[model samples]
Target chain A: MSKKWLSLISMVLAIGMVAVLAVGCGGPAKTDSTEIKIGGDFEITGGVANFGKSTVNGIQLAFKEVNAKGGILGKKIVLVLADNKSEPSEAANAITKLITQDKVVTVLGPVASSNVLAASQIAIDNKIPLLTATATASKVTVGDDGKVKDYIFRACFIDPFQGEVMANFAAKSLKVKTAAIYVDNASDYSKGLAQVFEEKFIKNGGQIVAREAFLAKDTDFKSALTKMKASNPDVIFIPAYYQEVGLIVKQARELGMNTPMIGTDGWDSPKVVEIAGAAALNNTFFSNHYSPEDKDPHVTSFVEAYKKEYGQVPDALAALGYDAALMLIDAIKRANSAEPAKIKDALAQTKNLQVSTGILTLDASHNPVKSAVVIELKDGKQTFKEKINP
Target chain B: MDSSSFLMQFAQQLINGVSLGSIYALIALGYTMVYGTIKLINFAHGDVYMVGAYIGFFATTVLGLGFLPALLLAMVGAGILGMFIERAAYRPLRNAPKIAVLITAIGVSLFLEYGSMLLVTPQPRTFPAVLSSTPIHIGGLIINSQQVLILGVSLFLMVVLTYVVNYTKLGKAMRAVSFDTDTARLMGIDVDKVISYTFAVGSALAAAAGVLVGVYYNSIDPLMGIMPGLKAFVAAVLGGIGVIPGAMLGGVLMGVIEALVSGFISSTFRDAAAFGILIIILLFKPAGLLGKNIREKV
Candidate 1:
């Protein structure tokens, strides 16, 4: 009976393979004249689903507008989305499927820095240009040997830039003499930002009174906060995602260690206010890619369109997603072809392209030399404070 | 650091540890009680705690119940779930190999975790503030109202548990069943009913711990039970697997050790410290701190 079942299963598999081959041979080529397919590898379902969902929304909106304007290069841009499920291994699988199976010309996203780093090598091997809107880790575009991955690029500024911006903001704007560094050990993004912030803060003539590390998903931070409180730094730099950040802030405030706290773009989610109460998040600041409150015509128009479409203000991830998609579209238009290698060259040479964020130009590292905005949280509202240009 | 500052930090972390340990102790009770009777570790105990938190979340948010009512409702809901799980999953495996029952428990655990994740998307929900977390300072030591509530509720439950076990007729029957199920049945005590009651009581305690943790942490997720559950199981083992008071003591000690390790050594090693202690204890005292070694009859 077992042998008979095995034979039946093998026969079914043989028939399925034949059907797939027949369809492959008979069907039109995967990419046709009507649409130009780009791949979207995003965290559609796991821990950072909100980031992925927002990014996809921004990408969809950008493509919608571009397609309505008689398409890019006279062919409508079609985004083939694959969910990474917020796992790095799954991210590699998503990108591989997008490139090998779907055969997209360009791939965008997998928003988290770690996810981008995991999937970047695949794009490099496949010679397909991969652009990420919100992955700010320096390693996303550069290798360990300090060489840029030609096929990899990001629309947002690198971690060191944002870290330096915050370090400068704390030392100069906030006039902080001593600061503590609370880093998430589990995240490449958090560690990169924390490392840079430490160096730049000390370079800016400030002392790091305390440095502590925590794994992500740790709910209780009181013990660490108490330990850090003994040093009593003027400000605490927590370069972690909003989930842990909200808990840290709430626990810190509850513990009566209410020093000013600063963070990076990971704190941009509205969930931060929900997890950490509105009152607890007061006096906290985070560096972000773009602020919707910006008076720039490009930002206002993009913000208005995003609000009209999604019925909410676009966060930094959404803005970067839109910018990344627009930048890719711009590169494609400049190259005047849908070829991946040409698009990579055009992307590497990106110069002074006006987008929702600001005047975006690719640096030597394939990172955008754009400005970072400092957003101050007051009673759960993100009030724009200052914009620092690199 | 100066002696005064070091001492102050030590005291603060101690309070924090006890508060955390109380939650562990509450979950540990469920493990201890269920294991005491049936000798089967309910791996799904932690997920039951997670379900309880969600029940408390909905009770507070949807039904607009206050803290006490929501907590009570969560306990009742989880208690029923515990009984249902025991009846459906464990009862069939009563005469089966112990390994089979253990495997079923783990299967039930996974089912609850992913099933809840599917029901409530993997997104972490912010549990509404059921109690004011106003900090009360006593010298350099600061304690929040929520911490006080956790300690109060945990202590109250432990006292009630002690009384019921020592004085009540049902508790005597439960004790009898744990000692020898065949003898208890021969003595006309319905063994099945006692087992069901044990599960109900254990699950209710876990639910209470869940609600309290939600109040303390302010964030609840479907997978929240995995870590705390394992830690509570360790606490039960460290205290003496089937010993009630031992579970409490082990839990508080575990919490304090975790707090001190994170405070003095490093936060990254806190989890390592917990399992490390468990290994050391198991190596030295195979029967646990309070467990007595009884040679099995030939």
Candidate 2:
């Protein structure tokens, strides 16, 4: 009787272990319910942490609003966020983990153009849809055939458009017949903008009197500024991030080079004022996505909600992030499924979507066709000057 | 090419290079002096320079002090930091292997750099422009007041250091300690005091360099000192490590070479040319330009 009882107990224990093992090894149990999982890789902690954190907050708010409105296709959308540390290799790894580990169908972010370029290849290989929020490099979407890829989309206009807008403004409005460009040789974004701006300005009968280059981390612009001053340009074009831009402007002014300066979207940072004082930035201008003074209801609502959520006014980066999330949700709803191919098709067909920035229509290259706002610096504050549709 | 035009450009480039070279020499003095006495490379020396920049930034921006006062306070604050770093990190490893000390130095460097990043924003800040905005014209070439100030201060410091090392009693004790710590200690000199003083002096020079460069460039960042520090180290090595005047000579030579290469060849190859010169110099003169050959006791 004792032996029979022990055998039965042993058999029960063995069966329980097998059940646990089976559940553990068979992957997550898929509920027969409605839920769509999306992932995001952002540089939440690095040199550009402030921008990344704001972008993440914008995305999360969009997801929350969508879920409150009864999520896409009657399914609640879930977002899984990961930090990429602003490194290209880490961005790729984070995206890989998102797709393989989290089982997310669509991914968003990795904000900087360089990181987006590095990580998008993984999405391409895995056949997952990636909608970048703020990366504006023209090459982000165009392939060897000069066509948009099936898997990648961006919510921002490319660098060429931004470059042309600034060049046109400098030539026509500023009425500068000669200009000099000081570009960050190490940055692809800066190089691209400088190339396009030079090409367009020269074509418009503006002579590039000087073309000087410096490294990204260099702080000293005296020598470069001195060289530029010798060329006697009326205006200078600096297409780099705000950190370097601030120093360059201050150094240029300090060296007695009083040339008016213009820049691209990279100049939209509060740190610019903090670094280069208001005195140095008095006559600066730049091309940006949208101005806070824009009277569009969508933009105003986004501004209010963003201020309420973040306790600060949202910049172009935050607005682009919100728009990217909204557009992705809209695509998911139109496709009615989270399959990569279907979402890509829906994104390719995106049109007339009134985002916070403007009514964005996805061009053939998966870039947005929208208006670029020109902002001028007065007393270290950015004020809306004009808006040009390209 | 006409000799006059070539001479004019060459003179201008030389002045620009020397101004930059003086800043490098000021920072290199810190590295070479510390290595001269301790036989350990303080990798955190660069971060010390970075901290000095921040100190000046805060002193001016937040504390609202005058330029001279801010510079003095920055030097003092950086000196204290150097003392603390030596006490906490290097004091306990006084008897450790040279490699261990080197590793600790690197670790301290990373700690200071990342710590600064966490404390302050990683974005570069534009240093306030207070120096003379006027460019002094010499014939066809022009030089700024900041460059003149940097060159004057660096030369003054080098001369003062040379005087101290050759004449002062404390300087004699330092030299004695560097030559043979045991013998110096046996002869009634406090070796620890000498080493600490060495660090204090080195850190003071680095702080001055940091502040000067900040004013010169009109920008400061947490990671600004790494490349400059490395280049200065290379300059020290090129001039003969542990030799005071050699460091200054090496820095000026390196600077002029870099400027010439960028002006003549390409800016892309400037760094390569500087290092290539170092390699060639080291190949011929292993003891450096001013280094002495000392036989190992073992």
Candidate 3:
């Protein structure tokens, strides 16, 4: 009699698990007309949690400002957040829950390009518009087939633009005749920047003296730096995250290879200075979305407002996050509807929409055409160098 | 590449390899010594190294201690944690099957990793600089002061460990216990105390390596032990498990090979070369470079 009861309980558990899975996977989420739900799939807890937290903070600030002004279409906007854990697989799950369970009209976030790509499929499947703030890889908006992903849009400039900006800066501004490219092979963002930098540098009549790749989480880079030092390039383009970049720069300086090292916005975090030390970062520069030191009234106001809200200066990710939220809210106002299809149409038609970063205009590829700022490191502090317009 | 530059590059990479190998040697000593006495792999040894690094970080940053003090504190802290782990986890499973003990070791490793992760979070912390890293140029090859310090400290510890293992009364008791546990117990040498001493000494050495690695890399994380632990285990096996001198040799060889692979061949295959060497060693010389093959009486 006890054995029969145990088997029956096991059968019930199996059925219950299946039922839970069904409820999780299958759903047309209920729509509440009183408030518009916007999903946020963020990297709230992993390797790039800082980036995720900054982006969410910026998005939340934008929503708070919007809600204070009576929101859009007589409905207050609510942000439903899910932590992606800074992994691509977790990003897919986050987006799935946001769309299938929360029934949000639009989704924002995930700073890394690879994560945006991971979550894009879920949004496309659900026919909900997805806007990424800081994912700059070109393929985020366009698929590999060179077709625009209809349901996907971004608020930041593409990686090609950043690469071209740095390449032109290296050749025309710095007047470096030869360059070296050291990239992180693990990150698509790094590879994307390296490829374009190489092409544009060679096109500008500069030579690439050395090309080396290192995987993420590698602590020792002395051997690779020694190899690069032999070629003796004018500058090194390390298009990797700040974690590895800090070590690479530190080792390179220790090996007496003190040429200017340039990178992209991935080096915006202050931890780079902490790891590499201020002296090693003296001649380094990186392109970013916006500079907190910009004297422009729009930028100044945003910087002051962010400092008031978060009690710290907003980084590039936070600025881009605010811009993305502002763009999405502007589209909702233009479309005069909370429907995802209408929002996507209005987003595609965005023109001269002034944001925290710059005047954002959506291009044919669903990418924002905006200006980028170059920042230089001096004594471990970021200084505004130049702003280049597209 | 010209001959002069080629020679310089070779010399540079050699220095790099030696510095790196010394760190592996420090971790490998713990694995070999623990395996020598108890015959358990003690997979939690690497996590102890990681815990040592955190302790060092806290000692330097929170307690505001200098380099030597922080290093000594971390060594003592990790040593106590090692004893507690052995008592609470391994001692209970002493009479169990080998597989059961190994599984328990893996479980202990996971618990430490996740538990530390919960306390510290998954974010990687930057280790505070305890020493100047200015490079010294000599004969077209650059060597940093930190590298010199690592080599010096590791050598001193190895020498101390060798003297303790070879010339001390406790060393004799340890050898007897390792040879035959029942015989040693019968001879009135408290077998459990000897084993615990082995663990404490080995763990202290690993903690030193952990603190040194944190200084060298300028980064520390809770899960930092997983890869280095496996690599040190490989080093122990390659050097002849349960042998003191062999672990040191195996670790240095592994480090040099990895540096050469990264320098000449490719950085991508560096990790692959380590595991590949393990397979080759197991197939060709299962007794390892210094291990003696003992036939089991069945």
Best TM-score among the predictions, by candidate number: 1
For candidate 3, write residues B23-110 as lDDT tens digits. Answer: 8899999999889888999999999999999999999999989999999999999999988899999999999999999999999999
Evaluate fnat for each of the predicted models and list the values in order.
0.73, 0.19, 0.56
Error of 2 at B135 (Å): 5.4
What local distance difference test score does each model get?
0.92, 0.84, 0.90
| CAPRI band for model 3 | acceptable
- The reply for model 1, stretches above 4 Å from the true place, is A1-130, A137-140, A143-147, A305-312, A325-343, B1-4
Model 3, residue B176: what's the lDDT?
A: 89
Better of 1 and 3 by DockQ: 1
| Per-residue C-alpha lDDT of model 2 across residues B40-60, encoded as one tens digit per residue | 889999889999988988888
RMSD of each: 5.3, 7.3, 6.2
Ranked candidates (DockQ, high to low): 1, 3, 2
Instruction: Give candidate 3's TM-score.
Output: 0.85
A21-62 in candidate 3: lDDT tens per residue? 787556436667878999999999988898999999999999
Instruction: Identify the candidate with maximal lDDT.
Output: 1
Summing lDDT over every window of 10 consecutive residues in candidate 1 chain B, give the lowest-scoring window: B1-10
Better of 1 and 2 by TM-score: 1
Model 1 / residue A259 / CA error / Å: 0.3
Supply candidate 3's per-residue lDDT for A162: 86
TM-score of chain B of each: 0.98, 0.96, 0.97
